[model samples]
Target: MQTILSRVLKNSTFITSIISILLGILVGAIMMIMAGYDPILAYNALFASALLQPYDLGETIRTITPLILIGLAVALAFRTGLFNIGVEGQVIVGQLVAVIIGLKLGLPPVLHAVVAIIGGGLAGALWAAVPGLLKAIRGVHEVIVSIMMNFIALNLSNVLIRRWLAQGTDSTPEIPESASIQMDFLSQLFGGARVHVGIFIALVAAFIMYYLLWKTKLGYELRAVGYNPLASEYAGMSVKRNILLSMMISGSFAGIAGAAELLGTSGYQSIQATFTGIGFDGIAVALLGANTPIGVILASILFGVLTYGGGNMQFEAGVPFEVIRVVFAAIILFVAANISGPLVNLFSKRRRDKHRARHLD
Candidate 1:
């Protein structure tokens, strides 16, 4: 038992992530005490509201649905050593295309939904492809391009929504029933919580991402390139192609998230002056999960629970929701700090040098 425990504790990444979470919670509790609130009562109310009731549970699952896909999008890019900040842009364009297809295309019920989902994925892929192409061909950094693409996608989407789709309105028409992904039986089971079939789609996507990254030839190439692009190129792999393909694949996952949102959650495209922040949250989720598919699911669940339950903390315990946000930011910060090997090494070096110089003197 001691040996087993030792081995388990030796996994630095796992230990770091767990410690970060605990420390974040500890900080939150301290803040609550300082603010004259009972931390235990607030936490209890949060979990109770999020998990103790069927309706809230269903909403939690619904929120987790898109997060799963978004996390996967960011995770895949990280696995391939590509920073896909364009996921937000991909999601925006994906929604725009999915809504348009859902409104304009007439088809059978199942087919209509399928087409909308596919359109969203393709749109995302196309949007992400531009940055990937530039990065591969011109040595441009993906982060810069994707960040700019986010603004472009946002403004373009707003224009399309106002001028073409809604006739000067800020939102588009609700999609037809044929394009809806809601499962009546599932919703009824969850006490009319508006959960949809997209959960299954998200699960399948997770499985596929796992299989593609760890079990197949293409997965091997992507991982290899991520490990060492120069070595991969020397071994006959096309670095440029892999770079582009990985970004496109990542974008497609983000696009599917957008499709799931429109078909099951929102049902219409609204002109947004601000980002939804789901794509950005995905970056945190991917990092928190250590860029693994299964990890992403767990991390997404953690985030989803907090998101759905924060309101209850406010209502039942008189704790402000901003406290929850601080806890979240702290978790990310600690996780980053723990994983920063250079920072740790630098401190260790300074300590050693100071001790050695004192001995010499």
Candidate 2:
């Protein structure tokens, strides 16, 4: 029975997540009907708007880009037993550096964009390194330090955007032509939505992250350290170094997330009325995707579709968009709590059985 339960659990992660999603949608529909909205109309409108229209679909993909990057960032860190809650801060710092480089440099368009992106990644790495160093060297709690750093980065970004980067108006100066990406091609293809090359970049990054985590020596050491730091240490691996490296790499991915948002989507540095909650959402994505690069990407796209569809749901049926967020939260909680462990175990057992059969043959 225990083995069967473990096998069931191993198969349940994806199935559980899917069930949670369906349950959430059903509940959302009930709520919408109770609120005097036509649930079917809202849901259909959402699906149509997110999928049927080219521009709408493109926008959905564009929204997915940053989510994929940040989701992977969170997953990478989580795999190594590090809770990096400072992705928000790392993203802000990266955006600042990208903006600065985009505005100041007089290089060619491609070169300017590349340099700015690299600069943003470096800035994020530096910011993440702080908490990493503290945790590794001083035995401080990374969760606390990362959370504090998030607050600092939030305040710092707001101040910098309003004071140093603002144009004659409140927002920062528009990025120069040389630094701007060519979204026109995507717009034309998608009927005027702002989809860009960033989506391709995200896909490439996902593959790169997969290779790094599954096929590389560093990845093995990182996972070992995460699973059992004492054992890793006994194996002659430097746990501190791996921790720092993981954090820095995680931050760099988040930096790319910010760059995708600022450079590819917004095209300028600006402060939001409230801190964007993408960092927190990344946690949900990571968990649902089972902390794998492929899973993260797919989960992020699922979220992107839901969000994009939610807007039309509101427009067509007058259902509040906040309800969509509620549904997403419920789904995430249920999937995280009841699914992953059993699913992984089942897969592991199946793989082991296969290996034994092959060897015997």
Which candidate has the highest lDDT of all?
Answer: 1
Error of 2 at 67 (Å): 0.4
Residue-level lDDT of model 2, residues 145-251, one tens digit each, is: 98898888888877888888886566778788677664677889998888877788778878988899899999999999999999999999999999999999999
Sliding window of 10 residues with minimal summed lDDT for model 2: 5-14
TM-score of 1: 0.92
Clashes of 2: 6
Listed in order, each prediction's TM-score against the native is 0.92, 0.90
What lDDT, from 0 to 1, does candidate 1 have? 0.89
**Candidate 1 on 1-361: residue-level lDDT in tens?**
5445444555546666777788788889999999999999999998899988888999889988988999999999999999998898899998999999999999999999999999999999999999999989998999999999999999999998898899567799999999999988988888889789888888899999999999998989998898899999999999999999999999999999999888998899999989989899899888888898888898889888988898789999999999988888888899888744544456566667887999999
CA lDDT, every model vs. true structure: 0.89, 0.84
Report how far residue 84 has shifted in candidate 1, in Å: 0.8
